[model samples]
Target: MIVVDGHCDVLWRLWEDPERSFSDGTLQAGAERLAAGNVRAQVFALFVPPQVPRGQRLKAALAMVDRWHGEVVENAGFRPLLWRDDVPRVTGGDRPWALLALEGAEALEGELVHLRVLYHLGLRMVGLTWNEANEAADGCGEARGGGLTRFGRSLVEEINRLSLLLDVAHLSERGFWEAAEHYDGPLVASHANCRAVHDHPRNLTDDQLRAIAESGGVVGLTFVPAFLTGGEATRDDVRRHLEHAESVAGEDHVAFGSDFDGIDRVVAGLEHAACYAEWADYLLRYYPASSVEKWLAGNWLRVLAARLPARPMTNL
Candidate 1:
């Protein structure tokens, strides 16, 4: 079975001070684990933390993107994929598909010019905020769930114009509603669980889930234990959120967004990317192969196909 994970913090680890690598050593979901699990593609998010200075955040993110790009360039087997045409080509051979993404719009630094710069750098997706308020949008973890700011609205316009995807995962309630109303394309909660099951701010509310579904978007059921069925979550706990998402958002909008290397509490059996097939096996008893395929990979590809243009990657 081919798996397409919607989000992972693998890039942060790959370029951090310690300098993580995927060349057959040192981590769980490296090239080795991915190949062993029959994984087709994995979206590695450059999730910028709030601890960094405002001016330096984008630089840090770009540094990570540059490092990954270098790895892809030096190794022909792995390539950076940004469009639908690249997807089929990257997944066709022994190569593992890599989709570059930004986990927060803070990297934009309240400037639209930065958006174009990041786009040119091969960023295909952007999450409006993390857990703190930024110039773009308010975050769920902020004290107040204020809506998108004026700059945030402008940011969305440029994002739509550039044909880049907008992720509302960490945005506040008001920000989410605003994004839904403003953006013309499908939305995504790259790594979030169902709030109906768990009351964490990181989880999505019922109305939020409905809005995404109505907009023809996908909700990647995150694997963080805290957001699962509460304390000490297991594989079954993660399944609970998936089942609820299928019922509310329908099977069409549910997908996997394991927040690997970013979260502390991961379900027991579903600890890493390689365990994707194991989770699929357990889900098969509850869902058909066709349904599982849509949840695991097809739904995500559909969202990308709908949002991104057929622009070619020119800059190396």
Candidate 2:
């Protein structure tokens, strides 16, 4: 299967530790492991934590992007999945394709010019906040639970105007709705589960799921234990979350985002990218081949086809 993970934290992990190998088994979404899993197209998130000093946050994010370009791309031989047409290059190929993503807009520092710089550097996806308030919007974990700020509303317009992917994975409920209202184009919750299933604040409500579907977007079911079950989470928890997401968002709007390397705890039997093939097998018993195909890769492919710009901004 030509699997595509909407989010992973390999870039941030690599930036944090310069000595690690991009293809080694140490990281959950290591290049070699993803190849084993047939995850041909992977989105590596350049995550800058809110804990990073305000001025240095963008520097940290840029450093991760540098790791992505200088290390992973060079050592792993992964092609950049720049345009929708670029998808076919990784189909059954020996090497996987890499798509750069920003997990939090703090790196942008409330400036659209930096967004253009990242876009020029091959950043295709952007998430507004991590777990706290930023100039863009409030995160789910923020106690105040505020919506998108005035700057955030403008950011949405700029993201849409530039034809970049907007991810609402960690946004507050009000921010999500506001972003949806501002962005009529496809927007994904790149690494989120169903809140109705586990009741985690990070997970999306059924209403949010439907809203994503309504906007022609996908919801990536992450493999975090806390978001899966109160007790020990296993492959079955993944199945249950997928079932709930499919029930709420329909098969067309559900896909996988491992959140690998970014997460401290992973579901049992789903330790790394290589384990996704096994997860796909388990899902087959519950869903049809076609639906399973969508969940594993097709849904994400559909979103990219619709959202990615037809031509590259070579002049910029």
Off by over 4 Å in 2: 313-316
Q: Give the lowest summed-lDDT range of ten residues in model 2.
A: 84-93
Give the candidate number with the greatest lDDT: 2
Q: How many residue pairs clash in each candidate?
A: 0, 0
Candidate 2 global Cα RMSD: 1.6
Q: TM-score each candidate.
A: 0.94, 0.96
The models' CA-based lDDT, in order, is 0.82, 0.87
The per-prediction CA RMSD against the true structure, in angstroms, equals 2.0, 1.6
Model 2 vs. true fold: TM: 0.96
Q: Model 1: per-residue lDDT, tens digit, 31-118?
A: 7666666668777788777788988988888887776687643552566667656655643676677778888788878888887887
What is the alpha-carbon lDDT of model 2 when measured against the actual structure?
A: 0.87
